[model samples]
Target: MDCILCGKCLEVCPLLRATGREELGPRAKADLSALLRGDAVALDAEDVARLAGLCLGCRRCREKCPQGVDVPALVAGLRAEHPDFRAWLWKTWLKRARELWPSSGMAAKLIPEKFQPERLAPFLKALSLLRGGPHVRPFVAVEALPDLRGETVLLFSGCTARYVRKEWRRAAEKLLEAMNAGLHKDKFECCGMGLESAGFGPDAARMREKNIRAWRRAGKPRVVTLCVSCHKGLADYADGFEDAAEAGEWAEALTPISALLLDGRYMLTENAPARVGYHRPCHATGNDLDHALLASVLGERLPTPDGRECCGFGGIMQLGAPELCSQVNERCWQSLAGSETVITGCSACAAQLTATAPEGVRVGHWLEMFDL
Candidate 1:
C-alpha cells in the first residue's frame, strides 16, 4: 500500500484532533515513512526521534487510509532504527513487571504534587491510578456460571491485573471455577504490545515466542484474556506459528473473558450509578463483545455520546510527549459528558481514563463492574 495524501486519516486521528498539529497526522507520517525507507533525505537524530514518537498507535488512521498504509508500522520501523531511553524503559517495565510494577504506585505517591511538573502528568497520573482508592463498587453479581465442566481454560491476566489489580484476576478465576472449567496455571509474561509499539521489535518477538511456548505446554487449551490489548496482542501472535493448522487453532483458542460470560446469569445491583459511561478501547476490533455485554445489561444507564474515542494511552508516547498524551486523554473524557462512572475493557484505557477523568468521575474495568 502507498500513500495517496488523503485527509481521511486526519479526520479520525485523536492526536491531530486534540493538538491540531498537521505534521503529526498520518499523511505527514506516511510521507516521512517513504523518505526514511528510501534514505532519500538526510534526517538528524532529533528529527528521527521526533517523528518516531509522534504517533499514538491507535490505528484509527489505518481504518481511514484509502491506500491502506499502516502509519503505526511505519512509525515502528522508524523507531527501530534509533534505539532510545523510552524504548529501554518500556521494555524493562514490561519484561520485569513482577519486580517493578507493584512498587510503581508507592513511587508515584512519594512524589508530592507540588514537585510534579506538567510534562510528567501523564506518567504520574497512570501511577496514581494504580494507587487505587476504596470508592470503586461492583454493579453486578454473578448468580450462575455456564456448565463447561469437562473443559479446561487458561486465563491470560495482563500485567495490570497480575500486579496492580488482583481483583480482576480473582473475579475471572471464580467465574471459571463456577463453570467447573479446569483452570490451568501458567506463568505468562507481558503480551508484548508495549514492546512492539515502542520499537523494541526483537524483545517483543522473544516475549511472543515465550508466551506461545507457555500455551503449548498447557496443552493449548482455550486462553481467556481480561484485557482488550492482551487479547489483540495474543491474537496477532498467530502469525508467529509456522504450521497453518496450528496457527488457526491458536487464533481460535484465544477468547475474551466477556465472551465466555455472555451466557452466564448475573444480578444487577444498586451499586450501579444512575449515569454510567462505557469507554470502548481502540484495540477492540470487531463487534466489541465487552461493549455488547455491557449494553445488554446497562441498557439506558450507559449513555456515552462517543464511547469509541481513543483514551490516548499511546504506549511509549507517554514517555516522550506526556503533555500531548494528556491532551488526547482530555478530549476522550469530553466525549462522555454526563458519565458519572466510566468502565472500559482494556487495563491501559482504564488507567488513562481514570487518570484524566473529571473531578467527580470514576473509571474502572468492565470486570470490576461484576462481583464474581
Candidate 2:
C-alpha cells in the first residue's frame, strides 16, 4: 500500500477541515474501509455505520490522492456492511416513482411560492427544480440545423433533471430541436448513483446493466446529459468499471450540454446579460473545457471564483452528518452570498446553495442562463 500516510488529504478534505476530526479524513477512513472490508477489523453494524457516515462521498480527496485509490468505492464496500436506515425506501421505492414524473404535470405540486427557499423543501428549492415552481426557464429554440443522417444523440435525463429539475429536461430538449439532430429517449432506469452511494452494489449493477441495454436499444446513440455525475457514471459503466476517461466514445458521448452547444451542436438564443456570479462545483476541476466555455459565455457577467469552496451536498452526508455538512457549506455560502442569482453547473451544489441562500437570492443551474 503506497498510501504514504502523509495526510495530504486532511489538508484538502472539506469534511475534515470542517469537523477537525482525523478519522473523518480520506486517508484514515479509506484505511478503515480496507480493514472492514478485509474483515481484519471486527466492527459491528453501528460501528460500520458510524465510519461510513463520516464520508461525504465528495471524492475531492480522491482527486488529490497520490496512490490514485478510489476511496468512495472502498467506502461503499464497507457501507454494505451496515447500510443507512430506510436506504431501500428512499433510494429505490420512492426515488424510482419520482423518476417517472419527469414529463408529468404532477411535478407542479412541489413548487414553492415566489421561489422562496423557506417556502420549499430542501429537495425542491433550486430554480425550476420542481418545474412546478415559478421561474422555469422558458425554452428558446435555436435555428434548426439541416437533417444530417445519423446525427442523433439520445438524452440521458438523470433523475436530478428527470424528477426534480424539470427545466433541465425542457432546456435540453430546446437544444436538441435547435441542432435539428435526431433526439430520442428510451426506457432508461436510474444511473445507479443512489444505489451505489447507498452501498447496494448488486442493485446498482443491475440498474447499470439495464441502462446499458436501453442505450443499446436506442441504437447506441451518443448520449448527452445535463448532469456531470450522470456523464461520469455512464462513462464508468461503458468502461466496465475502468477509468471512464479512458473508456473511449461511449464515455465521451456523455458530454455536458454547455460543451456540446459551444462545439456548435446547438445554437443558443441570445443572452440577456445580467450580473450573475458563477460557482465552480468541486467536480468542475475535471472538466476544464466546460469551465472555459462557461466563462466565455458569461464573459463580462462572470466574476472570479475566489473563496469558492464545496457546497457540502456530499451524497449521504446531508442526512448522516448535517452539522458537519453545514460547517462545510457555510464557507461556500459566504462566497455566493452577494449575487442575486448565483449560477452553477452542479445540481447538488445548486440544491445546497438554494437551501442556504437568503431570501430574494436564487441559485440556478448554469444551463438555465442560456434560457436556463
Candidate 3:
C-alpha cells in the first residue's frame, strides 16, 4: 500500500521541526518508499538507509494519516531489506561504542560527570553518554510477591524501567498495593521493539512467542506494564489474538498502569498538594487513548491547555536524534512551565525529560505523585 500522499502527518511531526528537512517528513518519506517500489529510479543504498534512520517512530504520523499507514513498519521493512546498511550506519557508527566498550552501566556511571557542552551537541553521542543508570540484565529473578490476589497481573518492566529508570517499578508496586492487586514477576524477553524497529522480523516474532509462553505459564492474569513500548506490543498481541478469534484466552490480560489506576475503585487522597503536568507518551496518545484516565486521577493537579503534548522520547528517537528530541522536549517542557513538577506514565518520557529538563523543574511518574 502506498502512503496516499496525505500531508496530515507533517502537521504534528516533531522531527520535522527539529531537522527542518521536508524530505524527512512522513508524506515525503512514504512517497519516496512507494516510488522506489514502483518503476522510479532506484535509490542509492545510503540514501535509502538514511531515509529509514530519520524516523523517530513516534507514531504521530500513524495518528494523523487518514489511510492509517504504519510508517514505522514501513521504515522497518526498508531497514530489513538492507541489513548491511543498517548495521554500518546504526549499529556500527552510532551504537557500537555503548554496545561494545564501557557497557551501559559504565556509561550511566559517567553521565553525571562527563556529559557536558562538547559531548551534548551531537545527538547519538549525547544519548550514549546519558546512560542514566546501569544496564539491567534482562530476566533476572527478583523476590516474588507474597501471595496472588484476586486477579494476577504480570508486570513487564522492559529494559529501561528494569535498569535505567528503576524508580518507576517502585511507584507502580506502591500503586498496585494500594489497589489491592497482585504482581507476578518473571523473566521475559525484551518486548522486541528494537528488533522490530531494526527490521528483524523473525527475531521479534520469536521474542513475542517467548513473552506469550511466559504469560501463559503465569496463569495469564492481567498484564500491566510501565513502558509505552511494552504496552504497544501487548496491544498488538490483543489485536492479533482477537483477529484470530482467540480473544480472552491469552495467558494474561494486558493494560497500561494508568488504566488500572483510572478504574475509580481505588481510594485517592483528598487535597493533594502537588501541581502536575502530564506528558503524554506518543504510543498512548497517538493510539488515541488521550490518557483521560490519568488526567482524571490528577484532577485539579493537572496542567492546563496542552496536556497531550509529547516529551520527545518515543522508541529510540532520542538516541538517534538527540537534538531533535531535545527540541521537541522543549515544547513539552514549555507546556509544563508553570507547574512545579511534570508527571508521565511512560518511563522513557520520564527519563528523557528528567535528564534534559530545565533546572528546578522536577520529573516524575503519575503513580509516584500519589501518597500510596
Tens digits of per-residue lDDT for model 1, 293-352: 887777788774384478988887887888788788878878888888888889888878
Candidate 3 lDDT = 0.61
Q: Count the backbone clashes (under 3 Å) in each candidate.
A: 0, 3, 3
2 or 3, which is superior by TM-score?
Answer: 2
Sliding window of 10 residues with minimal summed lDDT for model 2: 132-141
**Across residues 1-372, which tens digit of lDDT does each residue of candidate 3 receive?**
557666888887777865577887788878777877885358877667666766777777887788888888888887777654223333332233324333443433433443453433443343443354222111111122233357667788776555545566776776677566766786676676666777677767777778877876886667778777678765665332423434555523666776665445433454343665677777775442335755555567665536445676644444344566666777777777776666666656666676666666666655555443
Output the number of the TM-score-best candidate: 1
* Regions more than 4 Å wrong, model 2: 34-42, 93-150, 238-247, 263-274, 306-308
Clashing pairs in 3: 220-251, 220-252, 223-253
Structure candidate 1, residue pairs in collision? none
TM-score rank, highest first? Answer: 1, 2, 3
Candidate scoring better on lDDT of 1 and 2: 1
Per-model C-alpha lDDT, please?
Answer: 0.81, 0.65, 0.61
Global lDDT of model 2: 0.65
Clash pairs (backbone) in predicted model 2: 108-132, 129-164, 368-372
- Give the backbone clash total of model 2: 3
